[model samples]
Target chain A: MRTDLCDLLGIDHPIVGFSPSEHVVAAISRAGGLGVLGAVRFNDAAELDTVLTWLDRETGGRPYGVDVVMPSTVPTEGLPEDLNAMVPSGHHEFVERTLLRLGVPPLSAAQDRPGVLGWLHSVARAHVEVALNHPIRLIANALGPPPPDVISQAHDRGVLVAALAGRADHARSHVRSGVDIVVAQGYEAGGHTGEIAGMVLVPEVVDAVHVPVLAAGGIGSGRQIAAALALGARGVWMGSLWLGTTEYQSGHALREALLRATSSDTVRSRIYSGKPARLLRNRWTDAWSAQGAPAVLPMPLQNLLVSAAHDRLMASGDPTVVPMPVGQIVGRMNEVRPVAAVLSDLVTEADETLGRLHKLL
Target chain B: MRTDLCDLLGIDHPIVGFSPSEHVVAAISRAGGLGVLGAVRFNDAAELDTVLTWLDRETGGRPYGVDVVMPSTVPTEGLPEDLNAMVPSGHHEFVERTLLRLGVPPLSAAQDRPGVLGWLHSVARAHVEVALNHPIRLIANALGPPPPDVISQAHDRGVLVAALAGRADHARSHVRSGVDIVVAQGYEAGGHTGEIAGMVLVPEVVDAVHVPVLAAGGIGSGRQIAAALALGARGVWMGSLWLGTTEYQSGHALREALLRATSSDTVRSRIYSGKPARLLRNRWTDAWSAQGAPAVLPMPLQNLLVSAAHDRLMASGDPTVVPMPVGQIVGRMNEVRPVAAVLSDLVTEADETLGRLHKLL
Candidate 1:
């Protein structure tokens, strides 16, 4: 498990667990792997500050990182309120009509609206400021190459900057932008991703750039971890595998759905976010894909248009319509276990798989 | 370099080279890898018989395989002439207009019309009959599960049957339908393919089916072979990597284009075979993807519609508009080398890669 990545990150293992839950992040670090907190859901710097403080106390000064979604290209420019007006009325009507036809109820005024960054560059820069303020070991941009200033700021704070790339060209761009680590995420990964698979992209990115690369997408077990390293990645960056961990606070209905879904149950669509993201195939995705449906908008507008519909679905407690970003590895996540137990199984299985390979030689 | 797949198929190495030329196939088998002859180009049993007999004498008793394209679901049923009638005039007009605009010349009357199987089941059955008569070690179906009867027939002749699958469910279906091996191909693979990537699909298929799995798609190197093995595949099935080999009879212009093209120069479009296949992005693909382009026809009809245009493009001697099916690995294939040298490099590189992994452990 110990490799150049481990030495660089000062971790016992090269596995990096990504989650929005502070508990899962802390647990993964305590279990000898690097844990990264996804801060895209944070509404403001103050909310992020509180979460970082809690993570620092929970891990007891152990190394952890922060992940933010800052796409290299912004579809629109302006404040959230200004961008809200840019969405077409036809898209909004389509969402409403589809939800109404599906018998999904609307949300109450008292229910809280989920915070969406909406691909706004200003919102992402605020995330960078908050992440840099913490004693983080690494900062990763999920959508694309982090802006040059963000990379410089993280470096100034002695924090390594990483970016997720789906293509070899994107990985090279990240390296040129001063990223310290390149995370090659495949099409099977949750959230926004490129068409290339991890098996092909890892080796391509490794050859394209001089920096260490982390293999991501559809990775869950120790065997996959070994496969990533064999593909020339310094380590594996996993997200979907952490969604069902006991430490994470996934809703009961959503958790059960996650445990039951197969890899084929997911579809990559731009309905949830403006970019193509893999989420569990539900009525929502089918509605958007149905014939005569309005064309999906790009980036900020699409993200804005769907936010209200998502709130109504969540408030109504309709498990089938709720969007959950997950990778194809979700098929194997059939149980809820402690973070330590998951990490132990991964490490053990990877060792056994490697030993088996040695026997083959 | 050695695994159960090698022993099962009685080959010296686990690498399987896929090529249309008899010379490349014979050379690959002689160099310790399995050379699978692509027999889809043959119009009838007599044509296939002639090729198989030539391969038998060329390999000097070495084991090789035959590849046929028999999609599990036929888009339309009938003879080649009947299917040709089913193609709409609009699609025919689109093909002609696109070709004429691209400045492609008409095929010469003296040049033989290229044989196209056109996804008809009867043609595939004839291919199987021709293949089973030879001393073939394996029979691979490129599009879908070889029909159960085909698998049984191959088994009766003591030949193993393999099917290419782009999804885990597809692999499981292949095994249930009596395929002895499943070739897990990713989106980056050449020819007809699904959206799932090799990195994620290989392990999923390996876990879903009881039979040995061969990882395909963007695999073109020894390191990728090791990665497939680490992901639990018994072997690696490669196609695009063999296109640039010295033994392949690719035209001078096509060969030069292949050597110079990058990974990003390919696009998966339905223009070639009426199915989503990765081919070198050229004027033909661009024309079909352009605004106001007619909707591409399905399967056999689409395949039939494109055959004549492809013939014209090939006869024109213009490389820019020619359709060449290849994987993203084309970027790495910068040179033309003998089949033996390519096989040797793969085996040696895999051995060194395994050694490096051992050191990491």
Candidate 2:
């Protein structure tokens, strides 16, 4: 195995495992791939620091990274300074109307506090800056190209810079901006992405940009990994494939559902984020897609409202109207194995595919 | 305006207009584009010669091209020794059973000749030999990569070669095999294509192959032509957009329906060539998709069965089951104008689109 990615990242396969769990981040890095703890829903900068510190200690000096959602474009900075002031009358009223229509209880006065957007960029930057103060190997912008200062600062710290492009144009633009690697994401990817399917998008981005291309989106197995390489992607950036591993913090319901699903499942919808994103199509996503309903607000505002519903539904177990951002790759997340085992199998499968492809020539 | 594909075939634009009518082909080439007469169901050499001669005179020294379906993979050597030796008795009985069930007419004894697999390699090679004796500027293999001898001979004659690929892997393979140009076709394209869509597939193919990429699929207007160029394609390949112009040979029913379509009205189904091909979906195509209908046979075999049925249905004005391979671009085939009007509008549209794209920067 070429474990240079491990040596470079201070972990394994250059695979950046994305998760919401401190345990996963530590375990993945210990196994040789750096685990990126998602900080989207973290309520405060101080709380996030403890988790980062915990990850550092838990991994025994192995490197790790942090992820954040900084919109390439923000609608307005009308966000409130005080947490209390962030609550909107019409927005919450819309949420209340939806809950009433669904015959569910509204959030109580005690649970009326807003989300973490007021300081999301600053907090994420603080985390990145703090991680760089250590031996971290990379800093990636999840939503788009990272602001220029972040790119320069990462380079100054000898960390690599990466951005995701849903189409070839975006990938070329990233290369033009001097970004080191472009993640050519397909619609099969989790989170926010445009409508282009993965099998076609990878090679397009690889061809469009001079920078090394890492194929992301629905990559979960060795066979898929092989397919990506054959399509000319140098390496793979897996997200959903990591969500079902033992190290992940996925709830039993979603995890089990993921493990049982086949490739036929999953659909791209905009219910979770304001933008179109691929997820397993369930009643919640379906309900919003049907009939006369207000279209979801574009990002930032939509992200603000949906997080509150997710918080409530997790406790209520009312999955009918609550959803998660997962990818079509969830269908292939059939078992809970160690992160290292998954990585090992993926590389092995790729080897076999290359061997078979060679014989045909 | 350059009418023939220059340098390769001593013509104007490398644009080859594919139409069922020799008259239309002649007019298109005379008007400054290479008019390619489709030889799909050409009965024999004598009949083809008549059409070619007529085309030569009508175009007034303007060069033209010929398109033949010489697929890379074919199951058998095509037609058997004779009518008796060709189709199996069992297969013949099955056809009779189907025709009786559908309440169709029995075959006349004199007309029991084998179907037109007259374009089999040996025959097409003969046709090419005849064509080499003529003034064709380019030679295209519609189904896949043209044979090595076909490529070499065309090159020897100083004729250009073009092959179509719906995927990046295929496109790269074409370039590696010494192809001069690649037609990057998307699923929205008429004729055979994979499930990968155009907006995604075009750029991928462009990136994967070094040869100049011609974007094909649902492009019909100036805006779409500009979009293809923006996506990194060198030029554009059109098929369906020309089918409804007054110079083309479409009947009233087909032309009216095409004029009324939108971008969303087409479907990719293997009903036509036993290969995944996009066309305007209708009752005939839908009927076959519904159940356990025997899969369509590849190439000449499927062509053998469907063509006869289509002629009969079309004669009776009930072609609800006939599929005319059309692109999503059929939406723009909203008028019946002269071929010159269509060609000039496209160039103008592309120029305007480039202007708008620059404004975004």
Candidate 3:
């Protein structure tokens, strides 16, 4: 199961775990796999800096990474109120009406919303600045290639820059933009993804770029990791598999819903963050796809438009109306295991799977 | 490179080439792989009988198979004219207007249409009757499991029954219905496919059903075959790779379009057969997807309604309007080679890939 990626990333295994939970991130790093903390949930740079500082201490000198959302196109930058004002009333009404109809209760007090300003270039650049101030070994961008300045800044700090790509051309362009690694995220992946599946996209991206490629999407078990490597991927980047871990801080209702989900329980809809993100097919997603639903807003506006609604739904503790981004691998995430146990099982199973495949030759 | 599937099917390699061209089928079998001929094109029993007779002689006693379409639900059965009259005028106008807008010329004197009766139980039963009289080694159904009677009939003649499934539950049901082999067709596969991608679907199906599973969809190389084996599939069933072989009878224009395409050039749309089938994205598919286009009718009607337009597009010699059912693997079909060479390359590359993976262990 070892590859060049393990050496490059300074990890014991080639597996990379991605999650928004800082506990999960530190736990993964301590477990010998690279844990990447998703920074989209942090709008304040100081808050992110505090978390990274804690991560640096919690990981016990092990290497970890930070993932920031930087869309290729520069979006309108503002505070939460300004972005909320930009959202169309029809779209807002649709969300409100649908949430109300789905029995999602409202918040008594207005929750402090961050507006997903982290998706904007200005904030993501701040995230990079905060991330570099720590001992992070890798800096990852979600939607596109980090700016040349960001790439050079990370390089100067001796950190590798990785960008997620769904297509071969995107990977080549990422390499041209000076990225060190390309995460080939497939259509079955959570968050924003491209149309090609990992089985095809991984090989295509590997052929297109010289950098190490980590196959993403629909990869949960050891067999899937071996299959990804056989398809020419140097490693695997998994996010959905971590959502059910004990380290993931979420309500019991959401964990229960995820445990009950099958692979078919997810749908790729633009309703999430105005991009085609694979999300659980719950009442929230289904309502947006229903007849006469207003067209979703773009980029940060969509995220801002739905942030308050998300908070309300979370506050309500209603699983059916809660919004969660997950891949088809959710079907296989049947149990809640500790982070150490899950990582141990992944490595052991992969080693056994590789040995079995060797005998086939 | 061999698995239990090879010994069961009596082939040298665990590869199954699926094509509607008898020449391609015979070439695959003679080259030491099993080739399955698609029977949907032969609505007439006599026509299918003639082709099977030629295939039996052409392969020189090698093993081959036949694929028939049998939807789980019973569809309305009638002659071409009788079914054609049931099509709404608006739907007819949409097809006519679409073809006219796309510059597809009218066909010459209706072209002796057969009305896709092959999708019905009655016609498919006749197809099985004609196929069983020959030396066919296997019988495969595309849409669903073969009925109990059909499975028993094949078993009585010492023939194996295989069915395609996109989900673990579907594969289990197929095995329960007496299917010997289950083909885990992924979303990247050509023609009608389910939502699960191959990387996740293959392992899920293998764990669910005790029968041997053949990995299908997005497989066009030996490296993919090795990956499939790593994911626990006993064999690989390929369809799109054969479309570009020299034995395929498609027009030069359509062939050129296929060669020029990349992995992103295909879309899963119901316009092809009212089922979500992957097809080459072209002007025809684009028009049907555009706004103001009528909703695609259910199967058999959708096929009949667009059959003449498909013929007209073929006659127009316009690559942009021709309808072709292909998978994401079309991107790798760069040149037209003999079927024997393709099979040889697949086997050689697979062996080399297996050897390399063995060293990784």
Candidate 4:
């Protein structure tokens, strides 16, 4: 379990768990592998601060980190020349209407609830700054290379900067931009993914960059982790498996749905986030997939329209419309267990699989 | 379009277009790179005779190859293992019950419809024998590495041997066994696939083996081809795009499915062959995925039951149950044109994408 990543992070294993809940983050960190608290979902800075404080108190000085989204292309950055107005209004309307139709009665009441607006850039930056003030060991940027200033700032705080890359070229960008780590997320991953899936993506990124490559995408078990390490990834960064654990923060319905799911139960659909994110497929994703429905709206905008409604739908036990972001590996997550138990299982299974593999070699 | 793969394949481009139909194979072969004809569906002696004759006549003596499904781990030795009894009767009953329950009308009134029983190995051997009998240049094995005797036989004929590997270790085994080429089939690929996706699989295989590697997965457009080549692949093998071409013997329903598909529409399901193969998800796949249905039987058994129903379902003009095998890139297969045009576009796109990518480098 002790590898290059363990040496760098002062942890027992190279298993870096990514999750939205701070409690799970702290729990996993205490267990050994660093737990990275994802910041894309939170609306208020105070909530993040509260979560961080709780994590700090619970971990008893164990190392933990924070992650945020830094997309390579954005509507605000003006990269593709004409991407902002490029998306049709019908698409936006369709997304909004679908969320409206899927939401519970209380969702309409919370329709005007504060959303993750201006979060991609501004809020993400603010959270990073807040994270820097704390005893954070690492700061990771998802979707692309981190902004230049964020890299320098994290470096100034003795915090290592990590970035998620979908391609080898992106991994090269991370290395060139002074990233301490490159998290290679393949398409089998639960969140926003690109065309390149993990089996090819991981090693390509490993070869493309000089920095340590942490394998991400559909990695849930010890054997998978072993395969990643064997493929030359220094560590494994996972998200989907964390959702099914007892430590995960989830509504009754979403938890039930996740528990019921298998690997075949998910799909990489754009209906939820406008990006091709892997999520548990249900009647909602099915409806949009049919004819006559408008396309999904792009980022923050789609999230903006669906967030509160999503919250209400989950609370109302309406899984027909509520999307649960989980990777294809979710199929193996058939039971609820503690973070420590899951971590132990992964290490043990990986040891067994690696031992067997070594025999073959 | 020039790459390490082009250098290895001895072509102007690294693209290797795959088609079950030989006409498309010849068209791709004459265009520049190799064209591989799939032989899994090609029954024994006579059926292969017709197809190979068509390919040899059309290609005008140009170099082409045949792809076979040779599983190294099959439960056979001197004589091929008959997997009929190995497939649990429970699984077959499940299939029969499913068809009966779904009310899918039979494709033919004929009893004991032609199945994978008593044939695959002989068909595969016959295909190899016929291919060797032809003026072909290469032979590829899909399910696993080709048997040592087959490899030796193929090499003795001066026809190069290639094996599809889903992992670096698999590629390493092929290399150790003296395979000339290793096709890295990523999870993004259609048909029987390895657990690992292509992006990660490519470099791992490339780095692990001494032999040349061909990237196979969700590759379609030239950009994806360029990415594969850039990731240390010496060639790229494409499959899904061929189904939409003029030379393909596609039924009207299957062709419409491919034309209507987008990059977002496909998924990898084992519903067809009792193995995870990418295809357009439909009602049949959905039904099996629902609640507690018997798990899909492995390989030929699943193919036997599903193939019979598939024949009927496709003829019935309802794609909901007749979804055929394809890749994740089927979503990008939005038109039907000459296979040569598609192959050309892929090469052209690869060239443009490579140029842009080099700028970043």
State the TM-score of the second chain for every model.
Answer: 0.97, 0.85, 0.98, 0.90
The most accurate candidate by TM-score is 3
Where model 1 places Cα greater than 4 Å from the true spot, the runs are: A73-75, B73-77, B112-115
lDDT per residue (tens digit) for residues A154-180 in model 4: 899899988888777768877888999
Candidate that beats the other on DockQ, 3 or 4, i.e. the better one: 3
Candidate 1 displacement at residue A144 in angstroms: 2.9
| Ranking of candidates on DockQ, top first | 3, 1, 4, 2
TM-score (all chains, Cα) for each model: 0.96, 0.53, 0.98, 0.57
Docking class of 3: medium
Ranked by TM-score from best down, the candidates are: 3, 1, 4, 2
What TM-score quantifies how close candidate 3 is to the native fold?
0.98
Model 3 misplaced regions, further than 4 Å: A110-114, B110-114
In candidate 1, the second chain superimposes onto the true chain B with a TM-score of: 0.97
Instruction: For all candidates in order, state the fraction of native interface contacts they contain.
Output: 0.65, 0.01, 0.68, 0.11
What shift in Å separates residue A313 of candidate 1 from its native position after superposition? 2.3
- List model 3 lDDT by residue over B160-223, tens digit each: 9999999999999999899999999999999999998898899899999999999999999988
Clashing residue pairs for model 3 = none
The positional error of residue A264 in candidate 4, measured at the CA in angstroms, is: 2.1
The numbered model that scores best in DockQ is 3
Candidate 2, residues B1-361, lDDT tens digits: the string is: 2211244445554355677678678877887667877776676766677788888788889888777767776445544344235444554454445544544454456534545554366566666666666667766667667778778888898776778887787888777766777888776677777645555566667768877777787666655555455455666677787887778766665776677765445667765665778777766566556564566665555656655555543333333433578876665566788787887777665555444333221
Better of 2 and 3 by TM-score: 3
